[model samples]
Structure formats: C-alpha cells, structure tokens
Target: MGAGLSGLACAITLEKHGISPAVFEVRERLGDRFVNAESMLSILQKPITDPVAFFAEKNGIYLKPTASIQRLLVFSQSQKAEIEGSLGFINYRGRHEHAFERQLGRQVKSAIQYRSKATYEELLMEYTHVVVATGDGEYTRKMHNFRTDLTVSLKGAMVTGDFDRYTPCAWLDYSYMEKGYGYLLPLSDTEANLVMAYPDYPENDRLDVDERWGLFYERVCRDLRQPLRITSHFHVTGYPIGICRRARIGNTFFVGNCFGALMPFLGFGQFTALLTGIYAAYDICGKGAYEELTQPLRRSYENSLVLRRAVERLDNEDLDRIVPVLGSRWGESILQGKSFNALRWLAFALRPWMTKR
Candidate 1:
C-alpha cells in the first residue's frame, strides 16, 4: 500500500519475474512519508551489486566506495565525541519521493495508482490479492492483529547548514538518549546533517523549528569551539516512532513498519525500508504464479518479529555503548564487509515488508 523504496523494489522485482503488481501510496507524493534535511543514503556498493549498479548506471549516479566518509561524532546535550573512518557516502538530492516512482513508474506505470486511497474491503475486491506496505500506522495494526507495543519512542531531527569545514568525512554525535545518538553526516562542504534519536517518543505537536534552531546551532558551535551562524531555517517536524511485533496476517501481510521496524539506534530505518522492499518482491515471486502467497510471507514475518525484539533489547540495553564503540577502536575491530551480526542480516532479509508486490 506504499510506493516508497520497498514498494518500488517490489514492482521491479515482480516485473523481472513476469508478474505485474499494483502500488498504492497514501501520501500525495511518493517519498512524503519521511523527511531529511542533509543526509547520505550510504550504499556500500562496489561496482557490481545489482541495486548499486542499477542506480549508478541508470542515473549517472557515481559513488566513491573507498571510505571517503570519515569522522564519526556522537553528542548529548552535555557530552560529545568524534572518530575517524573511511566509510563511503552517497549524496542524493531532489524530490526523492518521486525519484524511485519515476523509475518504477516507467516499468509499471499502468500498475501504479498515485494520489489514491482504498479501504481494505474495497482493495480486496479490486485486486486478486492484497499486500499492505503502508508503513507504521493505525490501519496496519488493526488489519494484522499482531501483538505490538508502541511504548519505546524515538525522535529524528535533521538540519542542514554550513559547518567550519573541519571535517572531510561523516561525523556521528551519539551522546544523547543515554541510549541514543545524533548524526552529523556531511552531504558536502556547504551542507551538514544533524539527525538525532532519543528514547522518548517525539511530541506530536509540530516543532517550532526556528525557536529550537538555536539549540542545534549552539551545539555545533560549542562542539567545534567556533562561532556559528544560521543563515536560513529550512524545515522541521516530528513524528511518532514505534516497533511492531507481527509482520504478516492471513493474506494481508505487513511489510515495512507494518510488520516491524528497526530501532532508531543508528538511523537505519531507510536502509530497513529498502531491504524490506527487496524481500517483498522475493516472497511474492516465491508464491505460485496464481496461488495464495501468505505462507512465505508468514515465515518471513516471524523471522522479522524475532529480529525486531532483539534490536529493541539492544536499544533498551546498550545503544549508548554502540555509538561509543563505533567511535572506538573496539568497534573498528569488529565491523566487517557486509557482515554484521545476525540482526543486520535479518534487516536485509525483511526489506520487502514496505513494498507491495
């Protein structure tokens, strides 16, 4: 029921497997579900990963994979730290909400209905099968009846402005949340991102971004111990974040936040969204050409549930340590090429949950 990364990936994958699937997005635009000021969609691709190559070759999107990204910084209201690394980075600009839509739309334009809405019963009557990828929302919960707890909360804040040009790499500031952290990802010399995650659910009220702009500005100045200025105020808003317990139900399977979501420990929700989209395509393809497709989705859903719980525990227990470790030699010692713990693998396995295949 979404046309985001997962939904797009599923559309492409289904076409590859010779099956056409329709996509429905709630937002007026494709990528309106979330927002980012200055961030990097870090894709650790080296030349030939299908997804990587696809973006690069098709869009003239060239990325340097050799640790061009360095400098990991973490911050709390009172504490902050920085480290160095060679992690790669990708700078994607423009209305990304519509970027993927343009690509996928080209392949299956007939299959997608944008600016559209459909109730569950109405949807069931229109299509032979229904796959819900509507992200983490109320309808998803009622449809699946999965045991979910929206208690643990997270707030993501992003800012874009000029920094002192002291960094040639990415800097993550994870000193907040006692168990959370903030990021200072460099989109370029002129722009930097201030994204932070806190354990408390973000206040539903709109953030007076201008009023709080000074807080971030002061922090950056204090951290660098240099003068700072805000020439412009771009945009600001806060949304509620929670983790789900079940991913699939009967013929209606929940992918993306509908199934489960990764904690905001490291700002990997976008990565998770992308991953869930890919898996959704696979699961749908696994279903017989014209047969029911819920079994495989159920299996995948269970796996995601377990991983989500584990991540919640990690977020609840030791996220603070994770940032410190990432900035410390200890973390560098364990990070390997595309080989993180089983939890990461689980995220990769569940990317499709956000897509409609």
Candidate 2:
C-alpha cells in the first residue's frame, strides 16, 4: 500500500505479468519516502550465486546497483582487521533514493497513485489481490497479527571525509555497543555515513539517541585514530527485527519489512524485499506460493541468528579473534552462502520458529 522499493517493484512485476496493479503511496514526491526517511545506506552480503541477475532476467525487471563494496575494515576496541573479499553492495537510503526511485519510477509510473492513503480493507474490497509492503511499522502487527521478537534504535549521520569508499569499516567493540556494532560507510571520499546501532534499552528514553550515538562514536574515533567531521543532520529510527512467523494471511500477503524480511542481527532487507516483491506478483498470478518463496531466506537468517547472538556475548578480546576469522576461508564460506556450523562454538541462539507463507 506504499510506494517504497518493494511496492513499486511489485507494481512493475504485476504489470509485466499482464496484471494491472495500482500502487498507492502516502508521499507527494516519488522519492520523498527515502529523502525524509532513514539516512543510513544498507550493506548486503552477496549470495554465492547471482540471485538478482537470475530473477531480473527471468521477470524482465531491472535491479541496478548504485555502489559496490569490495572489502571491509573491521575493528574492536583494541584490534582492527581488514577483510579482503567481496563484502557486498550498498543501495543508499535518504536522498540517494531520489535517483533510485526515479529509475524505478520510469518503469512503473503508470501504476502508482501518489498521495493516496490506501488501506487493506479498501484494496481488498476493490481488487482480487492485496500485497502489503509498507515496511517495518505497527500497522503490519495490527493488521496481520504478526509478531515482533525485538527492535533496535539506529542513529545515523553523514560526515565529510576523504576515505576509501570500497572498504567499508565496522566496529564490534562490546564496551561501546554491546548488542550492536558501529560502521562508517563512504559513498565517496568527500561523503560518508557514521552509524551506531544497538538494542533499544530503557536507558535510551532518559538519554538522547544522538548523545548516546556520540558517546559510542567518540570511542570509535579515539580507538581507530580517525578525525571525522560530522556535516549533516542526524537521523534516527528503528525497525522491528528478528525472525517473522508468517508472510501471508489469507488474501493479504506481507512483503518487505511488513513480512519481517529484515535480518535481526545485521539489518539487511533490500535484497529480501525486492525478491519478495516479485514473488508477491508471482503469487498473485498463481505462479508461485509467497510463503514457499520466502522460506529459504528465513532459514538462512535463522541460521545466522547463531552468529548474531554470539557477537552479543563477545568482548574486545573475542571481537579481536573474530574479525580475523571473518576474513578466513571458513568465514568467507559462510558469508558466501555455504553451510557452516556456527553453533559448534558453544553458542546458542534463538531457534527458528515455524514460518507460514
């Protein structure tokens, strides 16, 4: 019911399959959602195979990558390691959406209705199919009765700097942020994003998020010997993370964050979102099952829960040991979508709940 990437993607896919779908958006401008929303660019780990190229070729849709990330400079409080390999890509958020959305707009402009508040009941009353891709919000839970296992507040800001955009930086210092990590991802040598993400706690309400982010960022700068200049306004928000239990409820199917597509540990959703959106169109055409389409990804994320939970329990010494391991062949295998027994390290994480499509 919204004109985010997923919604527009679904619109394009549906039209491609000869089903005319009307996408309704709350924003007046095509990319206003991105311009006014979160500022952090997402870092997605590439699959062993090219899922996007495969699907795009099959479905007649275009998935353009704005930036490619080749390596990552990972750090702890006292240690730093440069992981060399294909880390993944970054699809910028915030103002960067202007270009991306406009690119998608040309393909599906005829199907979108700007500044319209379309509801589930309203859409279902008029159309045979309804796919919700409104992203992570309370509406998904309220409408579909989906569950939220946990949520984390993320604070991000753009800074002026001359740094390597190819090698994004990550900090896993537990003392600074026990539940989550901090990152510095550069769009170019003159611009970058500084992000601090941690589990939402009771103390967050008492202290400001920017101040909290500053506290963590200060330690990152000091420990890493970086003199970054903050240049843009701070943006703060949270997504309902963790594994979702269901993707479809009767005629209404949830895609994107509405379907709990975000990975709780690292918050990568765009890759999942685009694939799910196309699957949603496929489901509407009776070509596939939405739940079945999303199950493999859910399983992969569930498997990753084992590593995510262990990172929470790690201290500086542990992070020091882990950063080097991520660059090793074993860690690279797992990151490349191969099977790895992360559980063998005496680590226990949340079990995968039975998910419905």
Report the number of clashing residue pairs per model: 26, 1
Cα-based lDDT for every prediction: 0.47, 0.67
Off by over 4 Å in 2: 33-52, 97-99, 203-208, 219-226, 242-244, 328-357
TM for every model, in the order presented, reads: 0.64, 0.85
Q: Mind giving the per-residue lDDT tens digits that candidate 2 earns over 1-357?
A: 877777877889888888888788777866663222221222233332444455467767665554566777777767767666655655456455434456577788465787887777889898877888877655677764666666776677777767776767888875654566788777766677788877765544456666667787787567547777877655545557754567777787788778766766677676677677888888998899988998877775665555566556567787788787777776666555433344322223344221210
Q: Residue 230 deviation, candidate 1, in Å? A: 4.9
**Candidate 2: which pairs clash?**
291-357
Residue-level lDDT tens digits of model 1 in 280-309: 666667744211332443343445444444
Over the full model, what C-alpha lDDT does candidate 1 score relative to the true structure?
A: 0.47
lDDT for position 231 in model 1: 35
Q: Judged by lDDT against the true structure, how good is candidate 2?
A: 0.67
